[model samples]
Target: MTDLLEQAVLTARNLPAERQDDLARMMLSYAGYDEPVIDLTPEEEADLIEAQAEMERGEFATDAEVEAVLSKFRP
Candidate 1:
């Protein structure tokens, strides 16, 4: 790997495992790998399907729900 990419991977090592997996997934997808970076559990798979259906049905979190979530990380 190039020095810049090596530095990025090293920096990502300090992140939480889930964030690291997300970065790895993006990298692999960009590299055109036709495979999953990680296997989702049955529940996760079902959740994704349900989320897609909700999106197709024009269902989304209300603004209050979004603000409530954002508030958790706000000072």
Candidate 2:
């Protein structure tokens, strides 16, 4: 490992367990590791199904609409 990475690991080793876990997750993400599977709740699953049905019916936002909605969040 590079000196900087070695130093980071050594520093992480001295951190609390939760901080170590957070650092490990950040490192995995930085290394392009796939995230852990997330099981959707029943309500979320229902929402996804409804969204799929809407998509099948061609009921979706247009690009302009999406851009307009996204622009609302920009500073």
Candidate 3:
């Protein structure tokens, strides 16, 4: 029961239901208290590392690539 967390809960209480849920999810994610595991094999890990290196080198898609994916699921 940290003072910061207690204050956050008190603040969230005044939010609308959707906003409250979004805030709760963000808080839990920040705290790393929610456990969702993604298991990857050694080769998959290597592939991911390579991909990340490429991204760091700016060898990646632009904002258009992301928006195209998101547009499909837009409500």
Candidate 4:
């Protein structure tokens, strides 16, 4: 393995089981494996459904609203 990947594996080894599993999924996907990487919780699924409903109803932020949020990060 590459030096960086060896180091990353060491770091990941120290993470919690859930976090390690998440990293493993990402690495497998990057290695060209076709598999589902994410398993969403019930609350997350509900949030996605609500977001879809909002989108279907044409509810969206205005351009000025977007700029207002972005301008906070400008130098």
| Best of the two (1, 3) by TM-score | 1
Off by over 4 Å in 3: 33-75
Candidate 1 lDDT by residue in tens digits, 1-75: 999999999999999999999999889897769664677899999999999999999999999999999999999
Each candidate: RMSD? 12.9, 12.2, 9.0, 13.7
TM-score of each: 0.49, 0.47, 0.42, 0.48
**The CA-based lDDT of model 3 is what?**
0.89
Per-residue lDDT tens digits for candidate 3, residues 2-66, read 99989989998999999999998887777666875567999999999999999899897779998
Query: Which model scores highest in TM-score?
Result: 1
Query: What digit string (tens of lDDT, one per residue) describes model 4 on residues 1-75?
Result: 999999999999999999999999888887658865577899999999999999999999999999999999999
Determine the backbone clash count of candidate 2. Answer: 0
| Superposition TM-score, candidate 3 onto the true structure | 0.42
lDDT of 2 by residue, 1-75 (tens): 999999999999999999999999888987768775567999999999999999999998999999999999999
Give the whole-model CA lDDT for all candidates, comma-separated: 0.93, 0.93, 0.89, 0.93
Q: Which pairs of residues have clashing backbones in candidate 3?
A: none
lDDT assessment of candidate 4: 0.93
